[model samples]
Each structure stands twice: as structure tokens, then as C-alpha cells.
Target: MTTDSKRKGIRLPRPLAIFVWAYMVWNLLPVVAAMAFSFNATRSRSQWQGFSTQWWSGTPLSLFDNEEYTAALKHSLELAAMTTVISTVLGTLLALVVTRIRGVAKRPVNFILMIPIVTPELILAVGLYLSLTFITVWPFSVVELGTPAQVVGQVTYTVGFVVVIIRGRIAVLGDGLEAAARDLGAGPIAALVLVLFRLLMPAVLVGAMISFAFSIDNFVITQYLSSDSSTVSIPMYLYTNARGGNTTPALNALATVLVVTTLLAVALASLLYRWATRRESVASDVTGTVALSA
Candidate 1:
């Protein structure tokens, strides 16, 4: 049977499908409602006062026009970008090194790397807060509780995710490609850059996107490390203003910006991943064909 026909034949029960849809609606309904209200002409978050873009752009209280909200959004994007780059690079290197370690050291090194993944975010934040405050060494002293500390805390939290994603890709790929590159007279670093890194591009892209998403959504670490208004992120801003009596749909507009940006980053990364994987598959098939011909 055709794959589509087979899938239809094995379709889930009506009750299961209903439950799945219900669960999705249960979770997404509120989010959809909130987003819908972002365009409300009035300040009421609950009562829809007709659609308007004033919250987004027109007035002084709008998302872009308001200095405080604009600053927070800008800071959030900056933090996410910095954290994504730093975490992806560091995590990719750590994953490669950890994957190659021999006998006794491998297990311990891997366990250490995974500690941040399993640790609670609050705990990590608190630890970072203490470390940045008390540690008086050159590096620690230089890192005050602000953007620098926020970036460090976020990188510490996000690097684990990158390591996990890249290591899984590395495991699937194995060392054959790198070995082949070396056999072709490429140096170690050359083989790694040209062969392994090229193959790992999809995973790296995914890791960076995930890091960006997490950093944007992260509240506890960012809050703990924030020095003042300058370090306020979207999540922190949302938390502070979400329940205020004077709050407007502008808050929701800010939230929509965060959600849209994250979704765009993920969607773009997914597209790049698909394209990279397709190219890798084509290259592998062509290489195999040439080898067989030889």
C-alpha cells in the first residue's frame, strides 16, 4: 500500500484524536486569545475594543515608541543573539572533545557537562548570582551583574543544550567522514573544519536557534543577573507588568513580538536544516557512486 494509505489505515481512534485536539486547544486557546487582544483599540486586555495597531506602532505608549519597552526588547534580542553564538561555539567544541575522550575520563567529563542540563534553573541562577558577586578574580571581578553576567549565566545554561544536539549528530555521523578526509591528506584541523563541521552544520544551526529561543524566554537567570533597567529582558518586563492594573494591550504586543521572533528563528533554522540535510544526502550518494565506479 502507499505510505499515505497505510497511515490512514493505522489512524488513531476517534477518542484519541479528539483528546489530542482538545489538549492542543486547551494549551493554545489562551495564547491565541492574548495575541488577539494585542490589537485592541482600548487598554482592556479582556474586552476586545476593536482591532487597531496603536499598541504596536502608533502612539507614544506603543511597543516601538515607548523607550522602556523598546529598550527591553532590544536588550532581549541582543542577549539572545550573544548567548546563541557563544553557547553554540563553546558547546560544539565541548561536544567534539567530550566525544573523543578515552576510557576513564570520558564518563566523568560527560557527567560534568550534563550537570547544567539537569540542574534547576533557579539553582543555576542563584549560583551564578553568588559567583558573580563574591568571586574576586580577574575574570569574575570583571564580570559585574549586568549584561556580561547575564550573557555568562545564559551561556552556562544553554551550552548544555547545544552539546546534546551536536553530540547526537556526531554519534549518528561517526568518524568515517573525518577519517576519510585525513586519508585524503587533509590535516587534523583541516579535516575537522572541511568534513566534520560541514556535516554538522544542520545540528549547529538547530543548536543556535534553540539557544536563541531559550535565552529570549529565560527569566530567572536574566532577572538574577540584571543590574538595572538597562538589563531588563522581555520575560522580565512581562513578569513585572503582566498583572499591573494600568497595563495595556501594548504588553501583549511586546509578548507577540517575542513569540513571533522566536517562531521565525525556529522556522528559519528548520528550513536551513532541511536544505543542509538534503545536500548532505546528495553528496553522500554521489560519493558512494563514484567510489563504486572506481
Candidate 2:
């Protein structure tokens, strides 16, 4: 054992530590290389040139200056935003309903909810694509393939994720707080809004972030549902160019932007969740102390 381990009486097996480090390096090296290439002075992805912002903003071919790339980025952000909102709201409500309503139907409802989670994305994409294109069901049929279709497809998949997060949080928090609120003279609606919703804010934020990340990174559904160049998302655009063997460092720049955006979102959510939980804990402790003193 190392001196620290001998002193503290704690040791991670050296072999396990080595394996974990190897796994992290193996997984992250390619991503780091890609991000580094975003700043490359040349178009070569394999060879590193001196750092430059040409691909990001300095030149006309840059992500900010290029019309197609800019449009694709905008489309991705807009779609992610719309999907996040819709999925978070709908998923939260569905989770609440599923958790509160107890009976034989619960298992079936849960199974139905999880179908999208376990089903293959390609299958879901094809199904949605066909339904949108061929099925004429009045108002629903009026929705065309493009950003609207992309948003719908993303929300369909991401709602299940949001449901899972919020439901898990609900399971942890339990129904005790809501019951207490009701016993203290709050109506059901008031209890839900003032007590349950507050407790669920962290999970709601996490679910929204997951929805946003998934919507932004999604490829198959967006590709299948997209109508034309105008509807192309960042992933679709990247795939087309990369497959064409004419991809520039601009693609790397775009990918870096996506990675950084997602990282920032997750970091923010984690901070908020910590803050919320800490505040709730403090409040609970204070309440308990007050009751004890009384």
C-alpha cells in the first residue's frame, strides 16, 4: 500500500485504478483530439497545425460567418429549446399522473411509457417519418416534415427520458411532503404547486437539460424527418459533409460548440440541483428544530 493508504486505511486497488484511468483516456482522447482540431490552422484533422480561430470566426468559412453552418446551428438550438420545454412540461405531468394513480393500469401505463426508451431509434424514426408523411389524420396530418417534424420527433423520444428522471426523483421524495402540505390546510392544487413542484425543480431542470442535449445531438430521427437543406440540423449537416470526404475544421468547431454547450448546461443543472437540495435540507432541519423546541 502507498504511504497515504497505509496511514488513512483506505486504498483503491492499483489495477482497478489503472483500468479506470485507461478507460477514461481511451474514451476522451478522440474527443479531445477533435476539439483540438477545431482550432487547427489547417484543414487536416489528423495533423495539428498552430492554433487559429479561422474555423470558428476569423475567416468567411468560419462557423459564425458561414451561412449554411450558421443556419444549421440556429436550427439545432431552436429545435433543442422547443423540445426541452415541451418534453419537460409533458413529462412532468405524465410522471405525476403515473405516480399518483395506483391500480392494475399502472404497470401497463409504465410499460407504455418505457416503450420509447427501449425501442430502437431507427425504428422509431422510420415509424414517425412514415406516419407524418403518409397518415392523414386532420390537424396532426397538417404538420409537415422539417423543423416542426424534427421537434415532434425529438420530443417523442426525449419525453420518456424526462419522465424517467422526474419519476425517479418523485420516488425519492415520496408523497409525505404533499400529505403534510394537505394536512396543514393546503388544497391538492396548492400542495402540488407550492410543495411538490418546488421539490421537483431539480429533477425538472435535469430532465430539461437531458432533453436539450438529446435533441441537439440526435441524428437518425432528424435525418429521416428532415424535408430539405433548410431543415438540416448540425448532426445531419456534419454527417453529410463528413461522408462526402470534404469536411473542414469548421465541422470540428461546430462539434466543439455542441460539446461545450452541453457541458455548460449539465454543469449549471448540477449546481442548481445542489443549491436546491441544500436549501431544502436546511429548511427541513429548521422546521424539525422548531417543532422539537415547541
Candidate 3:
């Protein structure tokens, strides 16, 4: 224990600590194995011959050079970008509406919005696929089984998560700032953009990060909605070739790329969140000091 922890008498239970470590190891072992074998000199995933960067670079079968792997990665990124933008905007608006609305209807509306999150991915995918295939109505008729469909499917599920996150932030923030902004002669839209939205920026970034992460790793929806080879994503590519007899360490390298991409995005989001919150704190402190002086 550290000095602070010791002083506070905060000793972690021995068995619980061991169990947590063990659980982490168990969950991470396969991912670690995959990443390690991606650098193997040979093609065998089970047996690591030696350390080499062949799968990551140099050859045609390498992650970046390989057409299939590159295409999949690109598609995954495109989907993630689209889904994140759309879901964040829509979810933020929905959360704002949900939080502001009063009375008995609010509970039902909130529950309705949460339906997509609670629905199973496979079922959701199947429903979207069937609807897009069979329903020839205006909007559904215009949409097809490709990137557009993938975006729609991803956004549907991802919006719920964004709503949940933004709503939690809204709950903590309350309506005081917005009310004050109104009292200061700011219009409703101005109050939203200048006061409330500034405070909610951290939550928006978090929602975008979650949406991107979910979209990038999404398999069932992407798979069901794919029209052809061009629409295949990284997750789809990995599923197709991971157990193949002719598969190489290149597959592992691709998986590593996906993992690294997600980690980088998460790191970036965390930094942004910290920056935003720090600004909010500083602004609040300044306002408090000014009020006290007055």
C-alpha cells in the first residue's frame, strides 16, 4: 500500500485482489497471444517461430499492403466515423429533449429510447436486414444493403448508448446554468449553444468515442447488411479468415491494428474529456471568485 492508503487503512483483500488479477489475465490471454503471434517469423499462430515484422510490413501479405485487410480496415473506419457523427448528434438532441420534457410521459419516452440498447445485436441485425430487404417503403426503399445500411444499423444501436451517457451528464448538471442563461437575456438556442452545450462537451466526446468503438467492432449488423466484398469490415474479415488453414500471421497483424486503433481513439477521447472538464472547472472557479468579490 502507498503512504496515503496505509494512513487511511485502505488494505485490499488478498483473495479479491488475486481474483481480479486472475480474471484480467484470463480475459487478456487470447488477445496477448494474438498480438504476440502477429510478429512471428512463420505463419503458424499456435507456435511462435521467432520475432519478425514480416506480417506488419515489407511483403504483399502484410497488414498495410494486403488489399483485403486494407479494404476492411478502411471500411471499418468509414463506418465508425459516420456512425459516431450521426449517433452523437441525434443522441445528444434526444437526450436534451428527454431531460427537458416534464410529467408522466417522460418515463415512457425514456424507456422507448432505451429499447434499441436492450435489444440483442443479432435480433436487431436480423430485423434491419429483413426490413431493408422486404419493406419497399419510401425511406427503406431508398436504403440498400451496403455502407448506407451499415451506418443506419450501427446508428440505431449506438444512439441509445450516446443518449444514456449524455442523459447521465445532463442529470448531474441539472438546469441551473440554462435557466441563468435565459435570465441573462440569451435566446433558447443561444443558451443551448453557448451555455449548456459547452458544459456537455465532455459527454458528447465520450458518446462519440463509445459510438466509434461499437461501430468499428460491430460484426452481426455489418455482416447482415453487407452487399458485397467491398462492404466487408475488419471484424467480418477477421471472422472469415481467423480459422482458415491458409491463414497467416497477417490476420493477427490486422487484429492488432484494430485493437491499436481502438486504444488510440480511447486515449484521445480521455485527453479531450480531461481538457474540457478542466476548462469548465476553471470557468466555474472564476465565476465564483467574481461573485464573491461583488
Write out the backbone clash pairs for model 3.
Answer: none
Q: On a 0 to 100 scale, what is the lDDT of residue 115 in model 3?
A: 85
Model 2, position 254, has a per-residue lDDT of 91
Could you tell me the lDDT of residue 178 within candidate 3? 97
CA RMSD per model (angstroms)? 3.4, 4.5, 3.8
Model 1 TM: 0.92
Q: Write the per-residue lDDT of candidate 3 for residues 83-184, one digit (tens) a residue.
A: 999999999999999988899999899899988889999999999999999999989999999999999999998999999999998988999999999999
User: TM-score of each candidate?
Assistant: 0.92, 0.90, 0.91
* The 10-residue segment with the lowest total lDDT in model 3: 1-10
Model 3 residue 246 lDDT? 96
Over the stretch 153-201, how does candidate 1's per-residue lDDT look in tens digits? 9999999999999999999999998999999999999999999998899
**Model 1 lDDT at residue 242:** 98
User: Model 2 segments beyond 4 Å from truth?
Assistant: 1-11, 280-294
Residue-by-residue lDDT tens digits, candidate 2, 228-258: 9888888888888865567789899998888
For model 1, the local distance difference test gives 0.92
Which residue window of length 10 is worst by lDDT in model 2? 1-10
RMSD of 3: 3.8
